[model samples]
Target: MGGESRIHNFGAGPAVLPLEVVTEVAESLPNMNDSGFGLMEVSHRSPAFQEVIDSAMGRMRRLLSVPDDYEVLFLQGGASTQFYMTALNLLSNGGAADFLVTGIWAKKALAEANRIGDGAAAWDDSSNGFKSVPGDGDYSVRDDAEYLHYTSNNTLFGTQFNHLPDSNGKPRVVDASSDICGAHLDVSKHDLIYAGAQKNLGPSGVTVVILSPWAASRGKEGLPTMLDYQTHISKGSMFNTPNTYGIFVLDKVLSWVERNGGLDGAIRRNQKKSGLIYDMLDGSDFWRPHAEVGSRSMMNVTWRLADEGLEDVFLSEAMDSGMGGLKGHRSVGGIRASLYNGCPVESVEALASFMAEFESRHG
Candidate 1:
């Protein structure tokens, strides 16, 4: 897809990607690393695929400044898996874990933790419609809590934590599915970090799991083989036939990030892209932006048309204008522009222009 064929996409997951990376992926589909096996058809145990996974892990370490003692594994399942796996592996026997319930995903994580042992909400913004994350003093961890879990960015509500939440010195577990490489994160501070690759990293099916030294060895025995983090860690994230094609695309995406100034660069661009939309939303009462000022996400900017019934019209016209994926999640029925690392500045400028024209005609 190119020029008129391509579009300014704002989908949440499996979002837009850099044209360069997409092109490279298409090129590699036929032959990858000069090997006889293609990217999708390559055996997980083959040498060519080994290089792909290795490069992905190494890039993740370098991009995030992950501590040397930490173990990085590209595992199956999505952030949903980490919700249960983290508690099963790290939560002490008969112990509880605390959660900051900022959105639907965090609430799901807490629910998953409860299935294993006890998961309590240290702080929750559900009462306020998931508009903001909590400050350190707003919540207290349980005395018996083994770890504190939080989602770095909430895609559905367009909220994000500007600073790391206070965990009361407990190990930090995060579901960073939406804003992993595009946002600021201190890998050394978190005991466990997991992200679904579909958003900022790559296509779906590949989930990056980073565990600290303690986390790697903290699991209780007798866990299922595939669900066990150590099982994958011991085999270098290849405990079974992994997501071969997904990992290869991930490596290519990371390579694109590396050449384009790494995580810092991605952050800068994400900020710029979201800022373009936020500025428009703030400048006019014609639009109602979600996620209070300081808690707004740099990845997803969501808002509603003040004029009733203009959302459908706006989406319809935006599609006609070559802009796609502006529809918000069902829970928040409005417009949502997900400006992930892959979304370029030009698309945002186009969206901003569209918003201006829509307001002029309808306001």
Candidate 2:
């Protein structure tokens, strides 16, 4: 605790939580609402917990400006479960789904859909080492496909679709786990949007699913009750003992987001944080960023040291200096600084200053 102020957390997911939220939760754990019991002791079916669950869903819809046509369900599994649920519900509708493989998550989603029914096209961009967005030109989609699936942000590769792909005539489905709440989305553009709450919303237990009524109607009939969107929507995301703690924290975070400026506010602050780091990468010869111009993610900034040999030394020193979780995914094998909503701008500025010092000493 002595050196806590000296450290900053930059982990991808299950990352930094707001100190205010943590403090409030810490205080409440002793005796919530003077009820002589903590939140952990409350019954999931009780009205107290139902209010918590309802408020979380309400905040989600308002903060994201989800349209009335959409149903927002906070499910138990992470976005990974959505990979299969999407296929089980949609792809099983007796038609294939078009998949645009932009990053690791998209590929995984497509693979799951393929297992259940049929994936119209692979759309492999692997030969490029996943550096750039897959070009939308000339690629054809099936007219009868259930839906077109894509991942909006590639967390591992540090690439983001700054512009959501124009779906042409197909229904758009997105895995937005990493970049969901970071900006204002034209929700009308996509029929379905799913994201795990761990990154920007709150914690790791809940996955947010927003589906247009028409898309929800397309879900296959007779699937397992839990995997069905209609089932979760009807239960108000309270079907089977929802993740109470996660939903409680998420509701608080949404309130925080609204007070701070909603999606536009998030976009402005994120740009500032990401810009600080991107500027340093561009100016410093010692640092090379993996994301191409116009395609960079404002959430996760992935970069490499000039020499791979220097990576370990840089990481070790960064850790010693009290900077946390700067290491990128092992698949990508570089440094990734994740600047989620909870991450203070001060953290990125401090990291940039350290990078500058490192470059000066090495040069």
Candidate 3:
């Protein structure tokens, strides 16, 4: 779908992608790089796919400013797998890790860590209905913790850590699934960063994992081959038939980012797009944003109508107005507009106008 057929896509994941990137992928689908092998049917061991993976990795490293020593892998199974995989490799021998349970994903990350070792929450916002991310002073990491784990952005509640949480000098491991490339990130500060590519990078089934030297070399003595980072790293991210098409599309997307001014451009666009919606939310008491002012997410802007019963009406009107994916997550039960890297500023303006029109009619 292109041009008029495309509506404002704000679905959480398997989300919107750049039209340029999508067009390139679609063109490559039949015969990639003139290799005669379709993108989906190409062998992972082939030279064409090798070039694709290498380019994807190089672009990610440059875009994120990842340390030279850090290992970048394009793995399968999304960010959810890394929840247990991170713990399996980092905490397998038995050690404590502290977590900032900002939202559902962080809670799940910590719970998975506990199964492998001792994972405890240093601070959690669940009791507060996850309205904000905790300030460093609000939480205390364990003295003996191996590392500090946190989800950089809470997709469900639209809360994000504007500043890095104080890890108390421990290595930081983050699940940055929802807001990886679109948000401001210091890859060097964190020992490990794992993100599912669907949100901003490209499509689902491809995960970007960046690991520091320590994390790369910290594999346990007898980790299961598939779950172990070393296993994939040793084979150069080809432990199994990698996500061939996903990686190719990722490379194209990253190339698009490079042409569009890389990470800085993405950050600026995300801020601008989200700022428009936030301005509307803040100006009107008719709309109530879910996250605290200081902790709002630029990628996922979530909110409720002042009259809760109007939410369904709001979503319906949004769809009728040529907007799609305005529905909230089932659990969150409100509207969530995901302004990932791929989301355009024009879409936000359209939404803001729609909101104003709706409020004037319904308010």
Residue lDDT tens for model 2, 1-363: 233574699999987777777676667676655656687777778777777787888888887778987989888889999998988876654468888787888888987887788785536667777777766673667777768888888889888887767556878999989888886577778888999989888889889889987778876668889888888878877778888888888888887888888888888999999999999999968888998887788989999888988988888888987798999899888799999988888888989998888888774
Q: Write the residue-wise lDDT of candidate 1 on 1-363 in tens digits.
A: 464589999999989988988988888888887797777889988888888888899999999999999999999888888888988898876679999999999999999888888899999899898888888889999877888999999999999999988888889999999999999999999999999999999999999999999899888889988888889988998879999989888888888988998898999998888889999999889999988998999999988888648889999999999999989999888989999999999999999999999888888
Report the Cα lDDT for residue 350, model 2: 87
lDDT of each: 0.91, 0.83, 0.91
Judged by lDDT against the true structure, how good is candidate 3? Answer: 0.91
TM-score of each: 0.98, 0.95, 0.98
Residue 355 alpha-carbon offset, candidate 2, angstroms: 0.7
| Model 1: residue 294 alpha-carbon error in angstroms | 0.7
TM-score of 1: 0.98
lDDT-better candidate, 2 vs 3: 3
Q: How close is candidate 3 to the true structure, as a TM-score?
A: 0.98
Candidate 3: misplaced stretches above 4 Å?
A: none
